[model samples]
Target: MERLHKLFIYRKKLVRPYIEQLLKWMDIITYVMSALLIMTLVYEHGFLISFQEIGVINRLYHIVWVVFLVDTTLHLLLNYSDTRRKYRGLAWLLSVMLYLTLIPVVFHEPEIQGGIHTFWAFFNSRLYHVILLTLLSLLQLSNGIVRLLGRRTNPSLIFASSFLIFILIGAALLMLPRATYHGISFIDALFTATSATCVTGLVSVDVSSTFTPEGLFIIIMLIQIGGLGVMTLTSFFAMFFMGNTSLYNQLVVRDMVSSQSLSSLLSTLLYILGFTLAIEAAGMGIIFLGIHGTMDMTVREELAFSAFHSISAFCNAGFSTLPGNLGNEMVMHGHNTIYITISFLIILGGIGFPILVNLYETVTYEVKRIWHHYIKGNKRMRRKIHLYNLNTRIVLIMTAILLIVGTVVIVVLEWNNAFAGMSPTDKWVQAFFNATCPRTAGFSSVGMTTFSMQTLLLMVILMMIGGGTQSTAGGVKVNVFAVVMLNLRAILIGADKVTIFNRELSHDSIRRSNATLILYLLVVFAGIFSLSLLEPQASIMALVFECTSALSTVGSSLDLTPTLGSDSKLIIIILMFVGRVGVLTLMSSIIKQKKITKYRYPSDNIIIN
Candidate 1:
């Protein structure tokens, strides 16, 4: 040990440079290898590995193991003390774990050799290999994400790029034979991937019939990731577990997650993750209870069905494992509880992360205050009048207004027409669900074609209006809609400033809201025009609904999605991508914004009306 230490220390100047150079090359090699490794696993998942392919898979895994071993060794040798101190010697321990992957290679004893053979058997087991493959790949993926963010890339561009990457990856994964019932075309795969990643429920093919359980899992995974921005999951896991990331990386993540300051970044991430899982779990349970013993499904099937819909509804992705979605006969008629539960889940998810965080804080404060003042009989209790934030207040109000108006309108117009056969209680439940879904949960219980023309118009408006900003749901967002309405109200009422809840709305906020509204309309119109040209056989109203749905990331369709041509599908794909990542966000990412000029143009107003 002393001689080894002396050798490394004595030759530090002579050997350190080469070691450093080797480490750089190894890092590049590791990047390439890690990507290949993941692709290999994906390929294995897509198809049944042949007897011949098994050997090849083993060789590839062994190669990866060797690379990891070398990398870990060099990292330890280069800065032994630093690594030992870092993460409380976690790196050194993981290196030990890596070394254990060679146990089978080290011990070649037969079964009769007792303890040595038993050890060999354990290490040589397929389960160990599988676990190692998964563990290493995840670590690599997390590390790669950290490294990518470490480079000073524009956050918006990174945001767009990451979604594209996931879409492509999902597309490839979906195409795997094992993922699907038979097989699907690349175009269909791409469309499905884009839809899933964008949390838009639109599908060219029926998800229930087209995909195997494996494929559905992949789609759900994409929904979860897409529902939460890509940067969010990667950054949280990488930084929290790995530790010692660059400060710039943390700051970038801080902005992405809407943390008020660096100090609160961790809590914000935790809250976002906690809210997502907890709500989804609760939704799943409620859905399960509502549909229990009704679907002729097994225990496992019931749970899967519940979990899938819960995630889908909360993500507002609109995808459903059921053939006709929530409209399927099993639960559509009398399982009114299911409809109400799903609608509430969609509302919660669409309300935005900021609001969720604000609600959490408010709830916790109230709980603590109540406990201290009432339970503990304390004389003093902390209080805050402005517990709810401005954004939160606006979103809640707009969401409430939209839901009530949508419900009332749908019920008044469709009470006798579309919902003829349903009981009075059932009619109200269906009406409420239908109204709530248009704000964009894509789970349709009633056929779109059966709706009155007036109701369809209302849906179009609601779809375009969409859900809240920084939430899984998409569209112009409730925030922008509220802002624009307030601005208009201010103008009509002869007030210079738009005031709400005793707070004045900023001019910048009004300007941004107007810009978002205009941009959204322009994009939706462009999509409609393109689709009309590509699909001349389709009705103008259907084209309008399709474009609105795609652009708004609302999965509702007028039975027009399956019939669209390839070109039309591509157009919808672009719209879904744009809608999922905000139109403003995509434009800001691509088009460079010139720095603000010191001088401003003379103020002027253009004639209107």
Candidate 2:
């Protein structure tokens, strides 16, 4: 009778965890909860190692998770001694429990008369082995968060932190009375949050049917916050409240959003926010006016839809409440006017904050100063209030070139392919929108799956180039692209210095640009390779296009994201984070700095082709 009672108590405990409902580091708590769920599954399914069994493969993955977790925990404890000390009592107990649980594997006996490795013996252990591994992934996440917190000035880190926080908030919102549904899992919530925060348009469920207006609004909020960056908003408020700015904060904003200088950092942020709101609000009004006359929705619904799409369009965030993703319904209903308006928003939003600021200042000042001179002031006495920097010039010039080139190339390539059946005007419009949107803005009037390989490749290139610096768009950056072009031109001309607009480029700037380019390419390749391993049957171009889109935060996909398994989705998430924050920032945060030396190293030249 006592044994039966004890068993009942233990079984009850199995279903319900003993941990209290604490919201300290909620993200870490959720992550740990997920790992525990995986552990429970392993414990339920006893170890049955066989090469052909999918269960065995999955079990091994869990085991690997364990080992990885341990290494991560040890590193965290060693590096973050302060945290360890603060939780010394719990740390000591956890340390002892950790080793004790691994003792069986550590001292396991080998099978007699067989040449089995000792490590393989540990692998054959029961499913309870995951307990140790669960702690490892948790530790890794914790350590990463701690390290990120240390580099608070980094723009990428600020964006990443915001993405994480918004995701948690979005998840909580979905779990409320309105958002929950039969098929919605917490994992799905997390995935959706990641997609919105990263501005990747991969949807696992039918977004229109599955999410309610409240839920959809949460998503739109995440996309808008994620698109402009959380820090960008916070920084604006900080400047507003303090009525004074610090150089340190300026540096933070500059690094966070890729700004050019400290002089107009606050103004730049204000302009970005103001410009974004104005454009999106205008877009919503335009769409509402254009569609309310004929659309099926009620007045409230129309207003809601207009507002949601306006934010999404300006943010380059491709989430839609309509099914099939902005299909021919809008066009057939004569709401094509909204499409053109959205295209304008996308183009303007994709132009980097720096370019936008410089353009505004230059044009506004030039016009005012010219008028002043014509109104009886000496023309020679006129002084320009705004000066365009090299970075600004490069971004503006390259952006114009890219927009024209991308439009022309897309039109030419799709002329005989996807655009074959459309009328001349519609074809041109579709091609133009496609050319602009895929670079960062993810809205699509045409089906991505129907595009030819050439068109897809062209999109991949455009997405990879992305938008301008410090803008809502992602990519290696237009300034970097411009610098590379200049460097190539210099090489071809046998010049020692790369100069543009009669001004010589700084070596440091060139080096940083080169580093950014190389790192971005490497990260993209890594994503491609990882995805390929998980999805062997997927096409190379499809994979490349998908990878590029995710890496550039351009949400266009060839109907691949929804079909990808958990592992593939995880890889995509990592790439999206990297792409949005930028590869160079991530690399700088990870790479340990070396000590400076007084002596200069000898220089040498290597032979080239």
Candidate 3:
């Protein structure tokens, strides 16, 4: 026994260094394979598939798959304890899948041709092989992104760069021959790609009529990635599979999710993804049920519509599979349930993930405390809990106030104008949707151009206010709007400090908010001015609406979007990019300003006003 123990120890010592070296090489090889796999998928699906090319594609796919399988197996074996501890059943499931993928290799030719034999033969068929390869490709792609992100430090830069990369890739894919029914220009593809990647949903061409199924799928993927933020998704996969999240990674995640502490970063990420999927799934079911028998679509088509709209609504992307967007009779009439459910999803998504996490923790804590007090008869367990943070309080209060006031304002202004032909119920529903949509959702149940000038102006304001920070929604952000308002109120009241919920707002926070607001306005004004010059035939009101929509990342647009000059579209694209990545973040990423100064400067006051 002693001799065996000594031998085991010696073996482990010798293998440790070699395992580490192998892992480094595996990382590089895995990334390269993932890129190759993506290229393969693009080539196969983007163009006409020839019978002769099938064999070559199959061989390349098989080689990449074998490498991935081996790499994953070795990784699991080398870090079994860590993998098991982190993923537990997931690790076992992956192992099972890997083994299952090898069945075709093991049994190249089966003698039997019926019953179970037939099933096995089908499983080993080319169709199954492609499906398996596709799954492996997605895994490798995710793994590659995670590894790449882990090596980066600046979370803001990574966040910005990831969107740019996704936009470029999406554009390239959309330009493929099979992606669009009629071949699209590169600029149009780039616009569509940026629109999808930024989750802005502003399209130069009609999505439903122009893009093929494959192109639509790519657009959906971009929306999902854009809405969730690439860094969050990549990090979740990394922490889930690797379980070796470094402190630097934790720090970056902490900032990205606006997490209060490093310890809860991983849990927070899990909650974000879990909540998103859960909400989207529930929305999908309701939407599917609502639109099933009403539309002319088959089961598969209805399912795709539900999934696409559910994702788009939850992401606040505003992309609809229907030609007329939400204004289509299919969604606005018998599908009232779809409209209401989508509205709920828009609200939930626009509310921000950090706020969702806060609500989750608060509810869970309170539930546990109540259960302990009632069931266990322990008064000590029911100690007072301060569940709401300042940010959460401010966001919730602002969001509620905005939604309520905006709804009321819209209902009143459009009661006789835009709501003239609709029933009271439909009127109220459309009014509520308009209110929420401008909170960066971008969906509209009524024609935007038909609205009264008052309603249109109100929409511009609501779009400008937008939703919360660290959310898929974009604008000046609710927090920034709140801060700016509080500051203005304090100035009017002659208060020395901006205070909210008995907490003094920090100087830096106020400054950043003010700067962001000013910069946002400047960009909007500049965009409007430029568009006016480029498209002189467009009305001033339409120009302002489009500019605000673009700057706020609200995809709503007048009929002008499709008719704009290339210069105007380019301006909108730039606005969408800036809006998705905040003005402040984009500025910081571009110009690396020093965070602190070594020396202090004297302050001087200049009289004005």
Candidate 4:
């Protein structure tokens, strides 16, 4: 090792500048390759490329592949130690794959060529090239994005812009010839893309009839991207693959993911992604089991349906491949388990990532304790106290209260109304499902038209008071609502402090909560008022419901979605964007905030009834 190190030092002194110069050129070339690769993918996927076009595309892919092949090889041969430590396994695996692409070309003997044929078919296929190129493109693009993060830019702006970029990309992809059936207009495509990207389920067109499997796949991909904030996915990929990012970059990611410490930034991101995929995978299985052999769908169709809905539900996107959504007769009748399972998945997703992390910590601690006490024969066990954080406790309590109350109320109100023909089990399941959905899960067990005015109003309220903070859910988050209510209680009791669970809320929290509620109300009211003018034919009640649903990022509608004017759709699109990105976040990005002053002005009390 010492001898090799000395030799490396000698070689570094001999040609260090050349190696450094090569690395710089490789960076620019890799970025160009990423851009070219994406354009090629879009060209191939978006249009029906002819044989000649395919050949051209394949040649382009080969060029990109060779570029990466050379890039990876140079890094390995020159800076192997640095690459190993920083890029870690990802760089090594990519290097191996890059070399493997040459196998079919290198091994030309007839006997050996027989085995290489299979290798050629796979490693040289368009699909393989697509995957490989996509990975490399993302890596390159993400590095650029991470570099941007290291700069002193407004994170909120970047956050909003990331979603915007995806929405536009998705809109463009959906406009592709093969993505939809017959065709689609740009406005409708934008609406669907915005809806999917925002995880807001309102569709101007029927997803089942209008979109092909490719389109649906695009929608689901958008949902997943939107479910996890766009910046989050990019940051995780960049950090997880590249490793040891700038402190500023780490801080930005830590803030985005709500990591408690710098050390746990990577782990927090992993937990978020890991928990999402695991839950969706598990939910997919549960859904498949519940609707198995009953939907008349083949196993492949069932699995696809299950995976799509599982992701949509967990993302709170509420997109459904079926025409009537979860209300489809095939799955809505006896498949109560699917409804219940979806409801729980929604809850789990909307419960917030911070709470998930907290729960994970609690679970891990308990498992270790039990393992030590029982398995290791240790008698002394640490007492479990305050396992839940203040935020977790507040959210869990509020969520439980909302779910239980909403379910009971819906059952009582909708028993002989919308759910008249259903059995007791179905009623409870449907009620819970509806109650769960308005909190940001878009799935519905019954048509919106069948619901009573009172039920609709209840749903509107539930939509306003959405799920937890930093969750896939939208609307005025439950955390803010809890804080506002606590503040209200404090005022009612003539107390200055908002206290709960032996913890007094910060003044800033109270102020922000009030601001958030007021902003949400303004946005919802403005949307409803504007929609009423633009969609004069729509009933006031329907307009109100539509406005609330759109602004809350809840996918439910009063059968008025398809009939809305283009102008009204644009309004809803804006609301969905605002709701998902957050009114405060948008405002923060747009409206420059003044630095905090060292002195405070005189304060006065306002007159109130």
Candidate 5:
């Protein structure tokens, strides 16, 4: 009795104080281990198939698979008391999905081929190859989710999760038998998933020839989610159904939208969301009527096609279900309907949302004033209501400049080179569409390879400049480029401050603008340098153009995608992700864990010529 009482007292003394402390330490260690596992997976590069050790590659993949499964199981068991079961359920679901997708690969016999890397040989499976591909894709998604979910709740987590999920679904779909699956290849599927999630339009296979109606529908959905960004869409819906949005969620939406935060961000987002859908619906209606009258499709098919194209176009996803892309139909018929409709859609979508809102408000205010004046028999009405905001003015001005410059350059340079065979009207239309689409829209009326070197260079410049912020379009953004140029001009003129359209810039805005410019250039250069090493024989101009297009998420390629090795494709993937999420934010996400000091040190200046 005395021993039992002493033991109970000792247990009581030992348990309570240390439990929470122990848990905290365990959480930290689990996070670190998870991160270390992710890093190992990234660097593994896996075994190549072919050559002497094809079987080895398959065995290695299986080993890695087993390792991940064990790790996942252990994590679930260890965290059972503190962590929610939902996480374990997620891990289980992920594992099941991966194993299910890889079932087809199990039937294939590995064959050794000469000169192939051992890792490549392991990936070799007949029809079952897709199984391995599907498993790898799911792993990526599961890892992304697990990583983000481990962190504190934030809006960025939502974007990261959605992006990963879309890729996983797209990958699994591609792994299905290609014949019944509408000619989809594993590479094409991965590329499409990456492009849509990144909102880059670089396609490995022709979208029109291969994708079934269901597949095309999937592609369109990706375009919409990718273009508007998943976080922005989800947050908008959340705000509509629920009155409140958390600050962390709002921050994620702002980052996704690339907004400047002039007013209540939630209200602005609501307006933008509602307005965007309305515009897209109207656009679909217009295009449907035009296409229905022109083509001989059934009503249901026509409506589906119209809706798909409208959403994709408005979102600037640049995906088309039509055979041979836009260039094909243009070849069949004269450049009359398709070019005009698509061009108009691209133009409207390229304009930033804030500008669209401003334009609507301006027009509505003017119309109301005019109506009131007419009723009272007043003489005049104002032409403009409240001067256009900085964002609006910059977008409009830069857009016009780029269009004019691009048109002139294309006409002058390509007139003799690629445009030699076309009529004057067709040539102009081709040039105009090419120029406009590179900002965001991926439509092409002419072969990319046919363009002159000068024209391609110009395209590189325009693509790097990209479209407006808070718009579906990607790139460095025209507004940022314009601000940088204006600042440079101001400095050259020896002005104390940068001025634009009779308004002085805020110091903070100018600093951010400059930083954005530098960061964008650095990213482009790094992409180009990396790609050049992978394909030494390719022209520097062509490689840079491709890199810029990927960085801009513009989807314009010079026919280099199909021939690129796995290394090059991975590099492009990185560029596309960076392009969608600004370079600044990507960098911040990496460095955010390290808290910076609040105190400022003394500053020093350097002289420049």
Candidate 6:
């Protein structure tokens, strides 16, 4: 027994490194196979396939399946102890599924078959192929994402690079002939892909009319991934599946989710994913019910529409299935419930995940405390109520203020102009939506071109202010805006320190806010100037609006995106990318931040503006 135990321990030690190496290679192969599989599927869908072509495709799929079967088997066998401990029965179930695939491949007897034949038939079905391919593709994608995020030294660069890779892949997928009804140009596809991946809704082509269902699916996927952020999504999967989140990964995620401590990083990510899925699912259901028996489309189409719009709104992507966008009569006529639901989704999405998490924690703690006090007469529990962090307080207060002020401003300005044709209730609803939409949701219930110049200018300011930091919404961020305001107030009051909620703001925070504002303005102005030179015939106001929209990732346009020249489109694309990633993050990724020196240089005060 002692000899056998020693041999088993030695075997485990020898196989561990081999297993790790095999897993690494498997990830690389899976990445390659995923790309190839997507290409094959796209090709098959795009072109009419002959029997020979179909046979080739089937053979390719079989090879991939065989590779997966072998890899999964080895992985299970080598890591049996760890897998059993981590995943319990799930590990065994996965192993079974992998092994079952081999049965269909080995037993090819056409004459002598009963239950086996039925099983083989089901396994060979198209639905099975799709399910298997999709699962493999997701697994491969998640693996790639996890590997990319494991970079501890330069997380920002890795994060940016991942999005760029996704953009390229999405462009390639969209450039396939079958992706669009009419084949799109590479540049146009790249633009659309970037826009979708950035969750910015600036489209070069009419999405509804140009893209096929496959194209729509790709766009939606990009939006969802982009909205949640590539790093956050990948880390979530890494924690759930691999369960090997290193301390470095935890620290990086701690920064991303704005968690107070490294210990809560995993839980914070789970909250983000769970909250997003829950909200989006609820929005989808509400939208489906609201539009049910109202639209002329079939149930499937309605469900698809609901799902698409729900995701778009929640992600703040602003991509719409309807050609006319939200201005379409199906929504604007009497679907007030749908409009309200969409607006709420936008609001929730705009509120950063951190803020939501904070709120959830706070409410949960309060509820528990209340329950304890009422049921158990625990007075100590009631007194232990936790206060929200400063970031959460500022974000919530500023967001509410902006929403209310924006709504009132828009209602007052457009009541007799844009709201002239609507009833009082509809007018208020539209006003509220228009206000909220400018804060990065970008959906429009009315024609933007029809809005007066004053209203457009107001929208530009609101867009510039943007939604919360670390949110799907883009722009300067509400936190920065609030900080700037507080700093200005301090200066005006002749105070020695800039403070908010009785907490002193740091000099670094103030400096970053100032730098962000200056850099944002510079970019916007530069874009406007360049666009003016490129599209000389376009109105200056329209050019400014376009620049602001691009820089803010607002997706709202004054009928200018499609009409712009290649140079203008490229500029807008760059702006959208920078906007979504944040000017600071992009700069940080490119410019190596110098470490602080203990010895300080002489300081001097500069002349004030």
- Estimate the TM-score of every prediction: 0.93, 0.71, 0.90, 0.94, 0.71, 0.91
Q: Give the C-alpha lDDT of model 2.
A: 0.71
Root-mean-square deviation (CA) per prediction? 3.1, 18.2, 3.4, 3.2, 12.8, 3.2
Q: Show model 2 residue runs off by greater than 4 Å.
A: 1-159, 175-177, 180-183, 242-247, 254-265, 374-387
Whole-model lDDT per candidate: 0.87, 0.71, 0.85, 0.90, 0.69, 0.85
Tens-digit lDDT track of model 6 for 433-457: 8989988877877999888888899
Q: What is the alpha-carbon lDDT for the whole of candidate 5?
A: 0.69
Query: What total of clashing residue pairs does each candidate reach?
Result: 0, 3, 0, 0, 13, 0
Kindly provide the TM-score of model 6 when superposed on the true structure, using C-alpha atoms: 0.91
lDDT of 3 by residue, 219-331 (tens): 99999999999888877766665465557677777788887798777788889999999999999999999988889899999999999999999998999878888888766
Best prediction by lDDT? 4
Candidate 1 runs further than 4 Å off: 1-17, 81-96, 102-124, 605-609
Whole-model lDDT, candidate 4?
A: 0.90
Better of 2 and 3 by TM-score: 3
- Measured by TM-score, how close is model 4 to the native structure? 0.94
Tens-digit lDDT string for candidate 2 (1-609): 999999998976764342212222443544565455444444333233355676655655555656544543643543354335334344444455555555555656655646454455554554435554454344434443333434554445455666667677666555555664444776667778777887766676778888876678778878888877777766654444333344555676666555557776767777888888888899999989988857678999899989988888888877777887777475433566777887877777777766677778788887887787888676776585328877777776787788788788878888878878777777777777888788777777778988887788888888888877777788887778888888999999999999988899999989998998898889889999999999998988889988888888888888888888888888887887788767877776556658888999899999988
Ranking by lDDT: 4, 1, 3, 6, 2, 5
Cα lDDT for residue 223, model 6?
96
Q: Rate residue 11 of model 6 by lDDT.
A: 95
Considering lDDT, which of the candidate structures 3 and 5 is the better prediction for this target? 3
Alpha-carbon runs more than 4 Å astray in model 4? 1-25, 73-85, 104-110, 113-127
